[model samples]
Target: MAPVKKHGRRRASVSASELAQMGVCERLVVFEHRYGKRRTVEQQQAIKRGRRAHARFYREGHMDWTRWWRYFIVFLIFGRWLTLCVAKWFQVRKPHHET
Candidate 1:
């Protein structure tokens, strides 16, 4: 016969420190059973605020990169065209055989 387990199921509880730890790693509270307590209104609000803050940060960072890329592309095209114009104005050409 299989040996019976002696330990009972553990109770689920969240302390203030656990709440803080949850902010760092949500999986920390994975042991909480389905019968455990639900999140409070304040926690829900904080989660919403965090999501908004992260979205704003992401948008602002990408906006800066998009603006920089536009300037870089414009510079590349205009610089190359200006360089060719200047060279042509100076009549830079090789012998016909070099073509």
Candidate 2:
């Protein structure tokens, strides 16, 4: 493997994926580096589908805090008011003789 030139110096570093590919078939890795990767039509379509699916999943999982923070603040206020109401109810329900 040739060392990659960086900052006027040769650096020898193998990425995890490169090492994995080397483990599988070092000759294939060499050939791929020399020429290029050639994928079938189905493989290309599958890659596109996978990219779209990942993008969809990312969008679905993302939270827009600008739109959601107001609701969260409202929920907190309502919870505090409910708690106070419940505490007052318990105080009112207690017998006068218990004091």
* Highest TM-score against the true fold, candidate: 1
Position 83, candidate 1: lDDT: 96
- lDDT (tens digit, per residue) of candidate 1 on 1-98: 11123575343654565668678765545534323546799988987898899899999999999999999999999999999999997797666786
The per-model lDDT (C-alpha) reads 0.73, 0.77
TM-score for each candidate, following the candidate numbering: 0.56, 0.52
Model 2: per-residue Cα lDDT over 14-36, one tens digit each: 65656788899988878876677
Clashes per candidate (backbone, < 3 Å): 0, 0
- The predictions' CA RMSDs to the true structure, in order, are 10.8, 5.6
Q: Pick the candidate with the highest lDDT.
A: 2
> Global CA lDDT of candidate 1, please?
0.73
Which 10 consecutive residues of model 2 have the lowest summed lDDT? 1-10
